[model samples]
Target: MSVVKMKLNGKAVSGDVEARTLLVDFIRQYQGMTGTHVGCDTSQCGACVVHVNGKAIKSCTTLAVACEGAEVTTVEGLAKGGDLHAMQAAFKEHHGLQCGFCTPGMIMSAIDIVKRNGKNVSEDVIRRELSGNICRCTGYHNIVKAVQAGAANM
Candidate 1:
């Protein structure tokens, strides 16, 4: 077994895991950070997205060992001082979610989108950048709107 150490949601955490263990499993199972969901183990769905070293990545397909000493941010990490992150607030206000199965990853990816594309991200860019993330709920009208609104507030 390989011992992997990483900062998870601003907390230092370590685990003894097999090299074949996926980061999603390490987060949810080992670290008990269940906010990062696993919709598709094949990486087809972006439901397992999380921030690793400030970039969004599919944790389901990412190796835990590869994330050793990395900074990992799950959905649970967004809020600070009991206040929801701007993106999360936007999602709630804009009604971006339905069943909420994909909300965590969607929010995570949205934050990354805002960070990479800047605060003034357009609707077209938001839609295109979110191509990897699928929402089987709404037509994504609200999700897009929330992303754009959240981008401005971020």
Candidate 2:
């Protein structure tokens, strides 16, 4: 077992985790942060995406030991002072999700995309970048729209 210490959301956390434990499992099981979901263990599905030191990453593919001393931000961290982030608001405004299984990761990735891609996000580009994330509900059209809208507001 390895003891990993990291900042989860905005709080300090430390735990004794097996070396093979995935960051997603560590976050959910030890930290009780439920917003990070594991859709596929292979990391092809970006449903388990979270921010590690300000960059979006697939937590399912990331080992907990690798994240020691890092800063991890799950979907639960996006809200500040009970206020939703702009991307979160846009997701809700555009009805970008149904069943809501993928919303957390989608929102995290969308915010990252907008931060890097800016407001001129094309639908095709959004779809291309979001290829790794699977959404069974909206068929991606609304998700793209939501990202575009969110990008404009960011």
Candidate 3:
């Protein structure tokens, strides 16, 4: 087992994990943070998306040991106090989610998109950037709207 330490959601966290342990496994199993969902285990699905050092990445494919000393932010870290993050609020306000399985990752990725593209991101750009995240229920119309609106608020 390898001992990995990092700042998780602004808090220092450490745990022993196998060398092959995925970051998602370390977060869900060791750190007990289930917000970062494990959808495909492979990198195809964006459900395991999380911010590593302020950049979005698929936690399922990333090794826990590779994240040592990095600052990780899961969906649970988006909100401050009890208020929702701008993206989360936009998702709720725009009805972006239906089944909700992909909401967390979608929000995380949307935040990253806005951060990179700025608040005035266009619809075409939002849709293009959201290609990685898949939502079977909403068909992405609402999700696109949510991302655009969230970008404005960000």
Candidate 4:
């Protein structure tokens, strides 16, 4: 087992995990944070995207030990005192989700995109930024709208 110490959702966490444990498994199984879903084990699907040190990363592709002393933020961390994050609120207001399987990762990625960019971001820019995240339900029409709206508020 390897020892990992990291800041998770504004809380300091330390644990011992098997060497092969993925970051997604560690967040869900060990930390009891299921917001980071494991849609595709191959890392092709961005369903397990999360913020590591303020950057997006595929939790399923990252080793738990690799996150030692890192700052990790999952979808669950997006809310504060029951109030949704601006991106989540914008997604809901713009109908950016369907079956909701990809919503978490989409929001995570979108938040990072807007944070890296800004409110004046363009549709084509959002589409290019969201290229890594796949949404089978919305067809990206409303998804783009959601990102733009979310960006405006951010």
lDDT of 3 at 73: 98
Please give each candidate's TM-score.
0.98, 0.96, 0.98, 0.97
Tens-digit lDDT string for candidate 4 (61-150): 999999998999999999899898888999999999898989899999999998888778899889998888888877999989998998
The residue ranges of model 1 lying beyond 4 angstroms of the native Cα positions read: none
From the highest lDDT down, the ranking of the candidates is 1, 3, 4, 2
C-alpha lDDT of all candidate models, in order: 0.94, 0.90, 0.93, 0.91
Clashes (candidate 1): 0
The count of residue-pair clashes in candidate 4 stands at: 0
Model 1 C-alpha lDDT per residue in residues 41-65, reported as the tens digit of each score? 8887799999999999999889999
Point out the worst 10-residue segment of candidate 1 by lDDT: 36-45
Give the local distance difference test score of model 2.
0.90
Best candidate (score: lDDT) = 1
> Stretches of candidate 4 above 4 Å error?
none
lDDT of residue 50 for candidate 4 = 99
Per-residue lDDT over 1-154 for candidate 2, one digit per residue giving the tens place of the 0 to 100 score: 9799999998999999999999999999998889899897898878999999999899999999999899999899988888888889899999999989998999999988887787888888898899889998778988888899988987
